[model samples]
Structures are given as structure tokens and as C-alpha cells.
Target: MWTEGQDTCISLGVMVCVVLLTGMARVLVRRHTRSTFIRVFVAELLATFQLCCCSHELQVLNELRPDTPSWTLTVIYFLSLVHGLTLVGAVSNPCGVLEQLALEQMPVWLGFLKIFAQMFSSGLSRTFMVWVWSLGISSRHFAERSIKCASPIHIALPEAFLVEMLCSFIFHSTVMHFQEVRLKFRIHMQAALITFLVFAGGNLTGAIFNPALALSLHLQCFHELFYNYLIVYCLAPSLGIMLMVLMFIHFLPWLHNMNRIHKNE
Candidate 1:
């Protein structure tokens, strides 16, 4: 068995390598490409790939060291912050792309392209992480490689759906509200909110609020029906985003106008 220290070092090395390579790619793409579409595509793919690979590695660490909740939460917060800071001009989540589409901030074709890039990178990340595990740099990784895929949901389907939905709602709502906030503070707030949501709902549903992320981390698991994953992981988060858009973009403004009319009357 590999030592704990070795496992930690290997996991950190993998994450650092992912970030460095993807970061470099993004820089090169930005420097070389004048087309906004190509730049966005490359950014989305590389950013989502980096996010998924690090997340998958952390999930392995969580499984291998189940007792280390603090470590897991800390790492999640740090990586979320890093992602928020580095993923400029990239929507790494399909849900975010759809939200932009819903609000007319992005054109239909561009949204579709972004979603495609997110999903393709998500799947690619899964394969890459599996190969990393197969290398068996540590006993933890070796053991993780042989483990059968299992569903993350530990509650009833309805409850699991609600957990994911609520998590997504809160997260997207915060993102909307943070639009005017300065970038430095906004990144920290976003990261803190993600860490909090993960802590709150992690036990029940793994608190994954991104459809692309759920696809990467849970879609292949065997313990649940495929439809079940669709309901809780995919549909619920999308619904949450829809609700947020409706409230923020449509309902609230209409309500305010109605109230003002009543006051005038």
C-alpha cells in the first residue's frame, strides 16, 4: 500500500498538471486565434476538461480517505476559486450556457456550441482520469480504479431531485446577483457559496448542480436507472436555472412595474 503522503502528492501533482496544461492552451488559443467563436470553444473545452479532471481526482481522494471531510471541503473551495478566477470568457457548465441563451445574452448557435464543447470535454476528462487511476501512482488510485461505479444519490428520488434543484437555484441566483460585484470579491463569494452548497447537500446527492459535471461524474454509474440520473442530475438543475431566469428576468421586473402602477393609482 502506498503511504498517505504519497497519495496526497500524486493527487496534487495531477491537479497541478491539469491546470498548467489547460491554462497554457487557453493562453495560446487567445494569442493565436482572432475568431471569437474559436477562442470561446477552446476556452470552454479546456476549462471544462480541467474542472472535470480535478473534480474526479478529488472524488477519488474523498473515497480513499472518507474520514477527511475537512480536507475535501478545503480542496473544493480552493479549486472553485481557482476555476472562477481562471475561466474567463468560458462557460464551463452547460446550465450556464443555457441560462445565457434564455436571457438572450448568447445566440442559439453559440450556446449550442458551448454546450457541445462542455459535454465533449466532460467525457474526455472522465477517460483521462480513468487512465490516471490506471497508472496506480499510489495505492489509493489503484484501489479506486477497480471500484465499480455507483450512484451518488443516497436519498429517495424526489428528495435527491430537490437537493440538486435547490443547490442549483441558490448557486445560479448568486451568480446573477454577483454580476455587478468586482471580480476579485465575486470569485471568492462564488467559491464560498459552492463550498457551502457542497457541504450542505453533499451527503444526499453529492451536490452537483452542473449538468455537464453530473454527466462527467455520475452518468456512467450503475446502481441507478439511467432515467433516475436524468431526473435528479440533469433535469432538476436545468429546471432550477429556468426558474431563476424566470424570476430574475421576468417575474420580478413585472411585479415591480405592477406595484408602481398600483402606487400611482
Candidate 2:
């Protein structure tokens, strides 16, 4: 028989798979719905649920695994790779929707609706995770291990906020840069950068730069109006993404100018 930790990991893995596949199925089934919002909503909701499960499972495994430093980092890299490839609809990120809004590529009303759908779906997913944990602990023999929140132990709130802001800014800039790169490299680049940032700042801000997940998860830990959730998770990411877009806009011409100078010389 497997150890309790091992069993819990297996169960969590299964849960993540189920939720992610459900989301993907929504993408496939979109033809029947004929409603863009509904399809997007289902995909976002289920995909973010899968993300939460993966995050929680990572937490559980790091504690149970041998030489957590090595195993955890590897798992983080694998998860990031899976995330970039699977979540094709840009599920559960209000900041991504905001980026679209800033670019004037999406209608304001549609963006707001997407954000609302994301939040609602995240809440449902979080609730499902919590409920599963509660039932598993009480009803099962091998699923007795504990779940952990990403606690900012040593860092100050302001520092954590700054870390989140910088992380988000870098993330959005990378997204913009990736758009210009070939698709072959984009997913790997996404995995590498996402894993890097999570490894660097996960302890401080749960490494969750996604506002929808932040609102669903962290809001449960802190008070309703807590700065930790608002400033770091919500506001900082939006501001960071906005700034990234602005900087990209203002400097885009410099790239052509530099190329022209190089050719002339």
C-alpha cells in the first residue's frame, strides 16, 4: 500500500487532470453553444480550478518529497509548461483581459463581463477544492495530509507588493515579446519565465499574478479589503500590465531606429 502522502498526491493529480480535461472539452464543445461568452466562461472556470489544484498539489508534494528544493523546482517547471500549452483561452487572468482592453482590441463591456465570469468561476473552483479537502480528510484513510497556503513569512507587505508588481510587469512584457517571436519558442519561453518567477517570488505572493485566482484564494486568507489581496494581487498586476503596454508602445519605434542605424553602419 502507498503512504498517505503518496496517495494524496495521486488523488490531487487526478483531480487536476479531471478539471483541466473538462475545460478543454468546453473548448471543443463551443460549436454547440454558439455563445462566445458561455464557452469562454466554462473554459476559464474549469481551467482555473485545475490551476488551483495544481498549486495546492505542488504545496503538498514539496513537503512530502525528498530534497524538496530539487523536486519542487522540477514540478514547478512541468506545471508551467502544462499551463501554457493547455489554457488556450487565457483562462482566469483578468490582467490578460485588461491588456486586451488597454490595446483597444476588446470592448470594455465584454472585458468586464469576462472578469466577472472569471471571478465567479474561480470562487466555484476554490469552493470545490476546499470541499474535497474537507471530505477527504474526514472520509478517507490515506488522504490525511495537510494543505498549505503560500505564506509570506519574512517579507514585508510592501516588499511583497513590489515583487508582485515587478513580476507582473516582466510577465506582460514577455507576453508582448513572445507575440513577436515564433510560436515554436513561445510555449517554452513561457514555461521557463513562469517557473523562474514562481521560484523567485512564490513565497512572497503565492506566485499568483492572476487576479482571478488571487481574488478566489487569497481573499479567503485575508480580510475583504486587505491590501495584501488588493494591492499585491489585483492592483499591482493591473498597474504592471498597463505600464508594460505603455512602455512597449513608446519604445516600439526604437527597435526600427536601431535596426536602421545598424544597416546604415
Local distance difference test, candidate 2? 0.70
What's the CA RMSD for each of the models? Answer: 1.6, 4.1
- For residues 122-219, could you state the per-residue lDDT of candidate 2 as single tens digits? 77766665666665542232223323333542477788778888988998888877787766578788878888897788766667788777755554
Note the residue pairs that clash in candidate 1. Answer: none
Q: What is the TM-score of each candidate against the true structure?
A: 0.95, 0.82
Please give the lDDT score at residue 216 for candidate 2: 59
Candidate of highest lDDT: 1
Off by over 4 Å in 1: 143-147, 222-224
Q: What is the lDDT of residue 135 in candidate 1?
A: 83
Q: What is the lDDT of residue 130 in candidate 1?
A: 81
Query: Per-residue lDDT tens digits of candidate 1, residues 1-265?
Result: 6787788878888898999989898878878899988887888999899999998888767875789898899999999988988887888998888789998998899999999999999889988888888887777675355246667789999999999999989999998998999999999999999999999999999999888888888655623478888889889999999999999899999999999999999
Candidate 1: Cα lDDT at 37: 83
